[model samples]
Target: MIPAGSGGRNRPIEHASFYAALPLIDDFERLSDTANFTALPEDWLIGVSDIEGSTAEIAKGRYKAVNMVGAAVISAQMNAMDGQPFPFVFGGDGATFAIWPEQARAAADAMRAVQRWALDEYGITLRAALVPVRDIRAAGLRIAVARYRVSDGVDYAMFHGGGASWAEQALKDGIYGFDPAPSGVRPDLTGLSCRWAPQSARNDMILSLVVVPVPGASARLYAQVAAEIVTLAQTLDRGGHPVPRDGPAMQWPPEGVALEARAQRRSGTLLRQRAGILFQTFMAWLLTRTGWTVGGFDARRYNRAVAGNSDFRKWDDGLKMTLDCDNETSKRIEALLAHYHDRGILRYGLHRQDSAIMTCIVPSIMRNDHIHFVDGAAGGYTAAATAMKVQG
Candidate 1:
């Protein structure tokens, strides 16, 4: 007997034999069926994502940037999904997905990847609204689909919303995904987006809420707006920041180049120059060893993506961003925060004080404050495997 939730051609035949009583439909039937009332399975992965702060980003009339971010995220999502029996709706400011229950976690993870891609690539924050199949349905869809019966375990193309056209009418009535207002949180990307917190949010899909368009803005400009939005992305949603120190780092290779030059000139700027190299080295080490892979980052093919300088770090050394930060460090911290501001991670904050690292991938959680990682569970950091005794 074929078990439930099996995929890749082994699903239908097994499901057919198991749930004989529940009318089964073939992939073709499910796809072409004109009926609406389809009894879905216990598991459902309803995924959705939106721009968190678009209004301010688009202030410079950079709609293309917004679309670029959206395109990247959606394309990434499509790749992650790899064709499931669900529907994807590009609802202007945001998107929605209706999928099988088993794929909820996978969908959530994919959505997160998409958001991170937007952040690391275009410096935008994508708010995700993931839910199960059984929760939060458009009344229109419910009314439209309640008439037909569907076969379980069969592949089907079941999408309801698409683009501006489908959502045009619904958007006006405030029924696209969910209401954006009333939460008191205004999005950087305003109009043409919304989200709602579904009531059945806990029944399935690991128990969560639907993160629809809950007041945000979109990327309007592309080139010039890049720096502006980049700063906002960091300031608004960003948290942990890299702490820096004064004087050349303790690990600069070409001591003569920076140090000798500093000694000769007796200038703090020269020492600062050496610090930049150390910072770059640290970033390189972390990228290679750690799992934190940069999206728009390319050392070999380093283009304007990581930096406007496609010409081999031609940009000002001081403008370069540094990560793998420390808090005790001050000068470097200020420099790093300046970099974050330039990248749209930090807003109008003062001198570097804390880490800019975020707590979770979720934008809302990240906005509160610094999500510094601690060693004990009492804090955000990890807990000791087991309690220890005092040496005395």
Candidate 2:
């Protein structure tokens, strides 16, 4: 007899099966209104990719490069699936995704390729690891999933299980695969970009935060604190939103040409690829400036949507947010969060910065579903991770 969580053609270990099991959320505007997520399939696996010494790299003012490698993980995995939808979240210095066992090998291979590419092309060491859901469950942890439609074509994954957090701990403890990929393998980071300049905070400061439930802490209390943080973020500048509504003005070839060159280094001849990108960027910039009709689509509106709909906050095993707030508001929020920390109910890290940076995956300029990953301009998630380590 086939074992539980087993798959046949109808139950192929793909995202569709998992999504099919979920009740779809048609309301895109009310993301926080969703109910608790359901348990994930035991036959699936969790894939993670993180940069070693990412904090140090960020300190060296290579935060953009760090963000680029992080996004590369998701990009590679998406390519591995050949347009299949899956549950994934992009951390500033890494990324985590749930994949079916059937596609685990492809996912693993893609991660390894990115690892190699990061080391060779950017001198960054990337750690790619995979843990089975069964193992996570055996460790007394669980992973639950929910789908939140962020826009007409974009849906974000909301993970409820602490399994993801436990898996990350396992990887850090050297429990799973942490070795380098074979030589000559390169990650396909198609459409990944760090083109925009750092977004100046309309508020006096932008806050980056990471919050985890402390041992013996009430889950309910932890969730309440998390919700409070989101509520505070909703009262920020720029339409009371965490992300900016206006897109960064794009120069002819964009500001970070070196980053663009590194991203497309694997595409073809470096010079030719760079030139092609420059030409495409010029055309896009011209269209947005002149309000020229491109296939009957509004170029200017698309640019704003890319910024306004970015993935700036996430809740995996822990709660993370990048909030744009004034100094007074930031202090008040910190004091509120500190009360929970003082009570030993949660472990959190908060960093203040003057601006936030974004890395994007624009599969198509016309697509409203493009994803932008945001982080504080200085250290962002790396700083939060550092503070948490100190607390531990």
The candidate that wins on lDDT is: 2
Model 2 residue 249 distance off true place after TM-score fit, in angstroms: 3.7
Q: List candidate 2 stretches off by more than 4 Å.
A: 1-15, 24-35, 238-242
Question: Candidate 2 lDDT, tens digit per residue, 1-392?
Answer: 00012233343645456754565554432333325577788888999777888988987989888988898889888766766677888888898898887788788889888888899888999887989999999988878877765556666777765788888778777788656688877777777877776777777887888887786688777777777777776666642345556566566667666676777677577788778778777777888889897777787888778766677777767777777778887887788878989998888888888888888877766666678888888898889878887976
Give candidates' CA RMSD values in order: 23.5, 4.3
Show pairs that collide, candidate 2: none
- Write down the TM-score of every candidate: 0.30, 0.91
- For model 1, what is the error of residue 306's alpha carbon versus the real structure, in angstroms, after optimal superposition? 31
Q: Which stretches of candidate 1 lie over 4 Å from their true place?
A: 1-42, 83-85, 137-392
lDDT tens per residue, model 1, 1-392: 01122343323433233222333332211222224234434344445555655544544443334444443334444434433223333322344445454445555555565555456435667666544333333322221111112112121123322222233334334343332222222222111111101111011111100111111222221212323322432442111112111111122242223322222222356567556545655564454345365664432222111111001000010112222223333233345544544554322212111221111001121121101111110101100001100100
| Whole-model lDDT, model 1 | 0.30
* Every candidate's lDDT: 0.30, 0.76
